[model samples]
Target: MSARDGLDADERHLLVVDDDDRIRDLLKKYLSRAGFRVTAAADAGQARKLMSMLDFDLMILDVMMPGEDGFSLTKSIRARPGRQTPVLILTARGLPDDRIEGLALGADDYLAKPFEPQELLLRVEAILRRAGPRPVVQRRLSLGPCTFDVERGELSRDGKPVRITEAEAQLLRTLAKAAHAPVDRLALAPDATDATGRAVDVQVTRLRRKIEADPKNPRYLQTVRGVGYMLAPDE
Candidate 1:
């Protein structure tokens, strides 16, 4: 599968967790044709089992299930120490509040039940683009209570996302590349050619608020005095 929208389709593995056999099969077929490797589970139990053995690029979880509901499952997954898997929730009860709750619970996107296959594909592709790439490398980095999945540009604390802005993610990506070493402020910008030192510092302070227990005295992301900043991987 060729890469689409910066997504390496050949390496994209999606987990479809739905108790409805008809919907699950239909989604699996549709998404597979769209060049994603789809794995379907009948319930959260089976989904959790598959998750343990595989690293999925994204998960499509249903809101209502027999034992463990999608909300609870998403919460549980987000609560894990290192897993920052993106989740897209599906539900028949597509109230405004429901969508808000799902988003608040750390879901990347949500789809109301009875959505068209094409719509689903569109949303999936959009989310994948927003989620970014899975670069082929030793890409996982620990930052205290949080872990950064370098390729995915995801930073999470105990599996819950820290919600860094795009620029901040770009900065972290640069810092993560040279963990234990200082990265120049200009080099931390999304575009080093146009970024100002003050802009970089502002972003660093924002990131520290999320990653550091005390932003005043940072532990993980540290200023290197005159050299710029360093991300110490010790914590």
Candidate 2:
């Protein structure tokens, strides 16, 4: 698969979760054409059902659902062994806290509402490349005043222990890997689903609440406008 919009196009399986049929079907078609096998869910509950029924290489989860939102489902999936399956979160709230929240939830990446499909493709490729067993330094990161240990699945500061929800850890890990460079918002989206850059922005903002000392003028996570996300992997 060729890389475009700074997103990669590796062939893979993707699961999309959203309440809206238009978004779900649109993503299913877009991702499929992008060289991925796509499955879809209307909400977290449906996503859970699909998870129980089948295996997907990647998942795209919607944050606001009727019940059992994306964050909840991500936590549940994080519990299973080797279920470290990558996830790209979807949300309408672009607040920093919300972005941080999704990262804290174990999502591989995220996308905000009103995003471009081409951007989503790029984001998917970035995640897929980083996940591969290459010597590339895409998966380790540092947040201000703290360290996010992706391999061990832990977040800490000054060697002090911090409790991270499984979902949060996943988000942190995803950003951490791309700490060396600015990971585009599109690259942080679900491989199987389509969402906007604004949504990814929200998830990043939420992650800051847990890592950065100040969410505003963040010291660790920084935004690269018209591009994607940049994580300061170390102090």
Scored against the true structure, residue 84 in model 1 reaches a CA lDDT of 73
Q: Which stretch of 10 consecutive residues in model 2 shows the poorest summed lDDT?
A: 133-142
Which ranges in model 2 have alpha carbons more than 4 Å from their true place? 1-11, 133-235
Specify the poorest-scoring 10-residue window by lDDT in model 1: 186-195
lDDT (0 to 1) per candidate: 0.81, 0.71
> What does candidate 2's lDDT look like per residue over 50-125, in tens digits?
5543446678888888877888888867755333678888778778898888889788888999899988877877
Tell me each candidate's TM-score: 0.57, 0.53
User: With candidate 1 superimposed using the best TM-score fit, by how many Å does residue 108's alpha carbon deviate from the native?
Assistant: 0.7
Residue 148 CA error for candidate 1 (Å)? 22
- Backbone clash pairs for candidate 1 read none
lDDT value, residue 187 of candidate 2 = 47
Top TM-score: which candidate number? Answer: 1
